[model samples]
Structure formats: C-alpha cells, structure tokens
Target: MGFTDFFSDVWDTFSHPSPDADAGGKASTNTPSSGTDEESGDEKDVNKDDAKDGEDSEQGHKPSGDDDEAEEEEEEETVDPKDELEEECRNSQGCAQPKHHFDECQERVTGQIESDGKAKEDCVEEFFHLAHCVTSCAAPKLFAQLK
Candidate 1:
C-alpha cells in the first residue's frame, strides 16, 4: 500500500476498532462462545475477574471536586513575602507622609488626564518618593530576618 493508504488504515483501525478485537487491534482469543460449553465456562470466569477489578477501582478513586477545593484552600492560605513587606511599609508611621503625597499626586494626575485627555506631568517623582520611603523602612527589617 501507498504511504497515505497505510496511515489511513492505521487511523481507521485505532478510531473504529472492531467489537471482537482487543485494544492492540488484534482479534480477542477469549471469545465468549464458539458453540462449545468449555469456552462459555471460561467467559464466565473472565467476567468475574473484570467485575472484581471494576469494584477495586471504584473503591480506590476519589471525586475530582474534593481535590480542587483542597488545592484552592492551600493557595489561599499562602502569602507572598514581597506583598507582606509592601503592606507593612504602607502601614508604618515612617511611610505615612510619603504615601499620602503619592496618593494625592495620583488623584491629581488622573483628573488631569480625564479632563484634558493627557497630563503634562506624570507622577513618577511622587511614586519614587513613596518607593524610597517604603524601601528605607523595609530593607533593614528584611535583612534582619534573613540568615
């Protein structure tokens, strides 16, 4: 057969397997009956083994929703160190003035942008002042906690 025909046959065999065939695309040797009592008896034994396996698998497997909820709870419990430090710095007495100045600058800049479609000045200086204050307060505390 040509290369395309060979691939097409392989795909068809995999996608639409015969009822009497195993997963490997070979005809099953353990046919239920061939008009013989012996083959029928063997089929009964095989069916019993399959039922036992199904029962074992059902007992072992847990529902997926429990795993998802457990994972989400774990994620919620964990907090990043950088975010913790930023919050601490924002709440510190040392950073209060700079934080206020930065907030005011941001509000003014946003208003200018809305009314004039652009602001002549960005709040980079105010942001830098706030960042500097936070860093000054946070760095010593961070280094003290480290090994």
Candidate 2:
C-alpha cells in the first residue's frame, strides 16, 4: 500500500480498534460478513485477476515504482532551513570560541563525575553561552533567507 493509505489504516486500527484485539495487540483475522455467497465468489474472481496482474488486491491499489522513488527523493531533498542555518552557525568562526568553552566545561564536568561519583558543577552556563552565540549568528542568516 501507499504511505498515506498505510498511515490511514494504522490510524483506523488504533482509533476504532476491534473488540477481538488479543492481549498481544493483534486484531483477529476474522473479517465481518459483507455479502452473500455469490457476491463473495465474484469478489474472489476479481482478487484472483488482481493477483495475476501483480497488484495488491487487498489494499485496492498498486503503487508505481517511479512515483515512490520520486516521493522519497523529494522528501530527502527538503532539508529544514532553520536546522541547516543552525548547523552552519555552530561550526562558523563566530561561535567557535563559545563552542570550545562549552566542550571543555562538559569534559571537566564529566571527568569530575567519573572520579568523585558526583559533579561539583554542571556545564549549563557554558552550554547556554554556546547556544546564545550560535543563535545570534544564525538568526540574521535565517531571517535573510526568509526575506
């Protein structure tokens, strides 16, 4: 099945769960009666034809490989701009000093915790300093891109 259909089925299964859902969370395979014997036989014939055509008869749809690949490519190509900007700013020269300070503080705090079974001080302040620097550097670029 296609992605949206799969998700829709999942949502339906959760939101309107069957009474016969087992303790293991699996719903019972017994489908409710829909029609008479002749109608069921007609449906079976259609299902057999669909199976011969290499289509997913149960889902009532077949996904093309090209469409699936194109969708995946588009998803992969669309990176969140804010995340990209933040990563760039963090690695930039303007934020390097604060990042280095945060790194050193983190190492010192971790070492103290390992040796003394507790840390005398945390790296929160240094981390905030680094965060502030990166945010300041990224904000202008991010806004520029938005404009």
Clashes of each: 0, 0
Point out the worst 10-residue segment of candidate 2 by lDDT.
30-39
Error of model 2, residue 59, in angstroms: 7.1
lDDT values for all models = 0.81, 0.82
Candidate 2's displacement at residue 121, Å, is: 1.2
lDDT of 2 by residue, 79-144 (tens): 789888999999999999999999898899889989999999988889899889888988888899
TM-score of each: 0.47, 0.50
Which residue pairs overlap in candidate 1's backbone? none
In model 1, what is the error at residue 24, expressed in angstroms?
A: 43
lDDT at residue 55 of model 2 (Cα atoms) = 57
Model 2, runs deviating above 4 Å: 1-70, 73-76
